[model samples]
Target: MAAGTATTAPTPEPAGRRLLRGKSWLATVPLLLFFLIGFGLPAVAIVTGAFTVSSDAETGAGSFTTANVTDSVQGAYWTALLSSIKLSALTALIGTAVGVPIAQAVLTSRFRMLREAVLTASGVLANFGGLPLAFAFVATLGNAGELTKLFHLTDHGWSLYSFTGLTVAYLYFLVPLMVLTITPALEGLRVQWREAAQNNRATGLQYWRHVALPILFPSLLGGFVLLFGSAFAAYATAAAMVGATVPLISRQIADALSGNVLVGQGNLALALSLDMIIVAVLVMAVYLPLQRRSARWLS
Candidate 1:
């Protein structure tokens, strides 16, 4: 350095900015702890337990083995898993198809109260499932139900305990969930885009096909993935309604845990849980990118 030249010190960060940064990080501590305790630890335990077999039931000691995971993908377990996947996919597809139009209608409606009512109802209904929902359906559609007797539906071969009935029950909640999910995306559609299409001599159908649908596709697909995960993980409703008759993976997991048919099968339950986690991870893998894409357009 030249002797005549003077050096300057770097400017320090403002105390308020430093405090804000510290507070922001402090706010995340509870959330981080929640994920660590509620998800991370349980996930680790499930993975470890899935790969080990109990050598002594009394002591809960186990040795490492891959048989639990191998068995989870075979026979009854595999069948149950497939059934779950099919059910979830079917419900999600139907829910999306039915929901998108309803959401659009709700969005375009002139009445503020109507929109508020539907959205509020949807928020409640989307979270409404499990035993109460099952019971309500059973009372309304069961063999001895009033509707069944009045319309002779049972004689016409409609059974609430069947797979078809389960699909119907799933839709009751899924459709509302889809509505709640896709309404914002529908609302995000700028009027200028439609006007621009109209200025180019495009019909409504052509405009939707060329522009609107493409823009909304990510939100639509993300909603489908969300509904699929919801249906896939649902257990209480299926358990209450159809019990073991449906052979769903959730039911299978419960059976394994309880040793309903097999003794000392807790490890098998962990394997099934791991399977569920993998499916959830895959669903999230697909959902997150779609969500990011949707946010780019919508936001």
Candidate 2:
């Protein structure tokens, strides 16, 4: 332990490993840049605008304020938020219930073409929302439309503009979205597990109750969160379908941003967007742990 004793130099990591790390980062550059430009900028704009006030009379720089955020949390906007939540939750539930069985059927199908067709259709339908979707439903179910007129359902007090009808219209896309989300989870139910259960003399019900459901539960819950967020943030579909009749948060955001055109209403819209971003963050917070748990079974 003499002061003059020579100390050993630490060994460096292997060249290949360091190069691998560098390459990994290099590979991610495009995606990282896209994330920075696409999502990051809008997020920054939303947060800053949510807190922004008018340009300073002296310096011409935006002043900071929380007034817009405060208003976003108050009466009408709050009500719209509640409406969005209720509608999103209900539709997500319905979509999951309906989509799960369809996914299961497709997953277990013997015919590959049938499965492929259904899956292809599902992919298309999941993305088939917004104004065009609204118009499609209107043309099909409106009072003067083919089925409605032929069946005379309008005389029986059926209205496509009601909350129930809006929920139904939402299902047009949502069910497919759920199917897309859950299909892979259903497929991830390994046949080995089923055969193993059978070897143990387990019934179909017993196997699902004890094993299958446990594995699938986390995935299912994650899908529900995704579905909820998607519906919560939906704008164009609700706007085109019911306009302001449904009082959704997205509708209010649009109104604040474009329709109202009041001074600083853009800030209010940005605050509403921040609220949505918060909800999405909360959803991911819950989903992350559940997804990690799911990986234990899936991996």
| Root mean square deviation (Cα) for candidate 2 | 5.8
Tens digits of per-residue lDDT, candidate 1, 189-256, equal 99999999999999999999989998899999989999999999999999999997788999998888
lDDT of 2: 0.87
Candidate with top lDDT is 1
Which segments of model 1 are wrong by more than 4 Å? 1-13
Separate clash counts for every candidate = 0, 0
The alpha-carbon lDDT assigned to residue 58 of candidate 1 equals: 93
Give stretches of model 2 more than 4 Å off.
1-23, 55-60, 259-261
Return the lDDT, model 1, position 190. 96
Local lDDT at 220 for model 2: 86
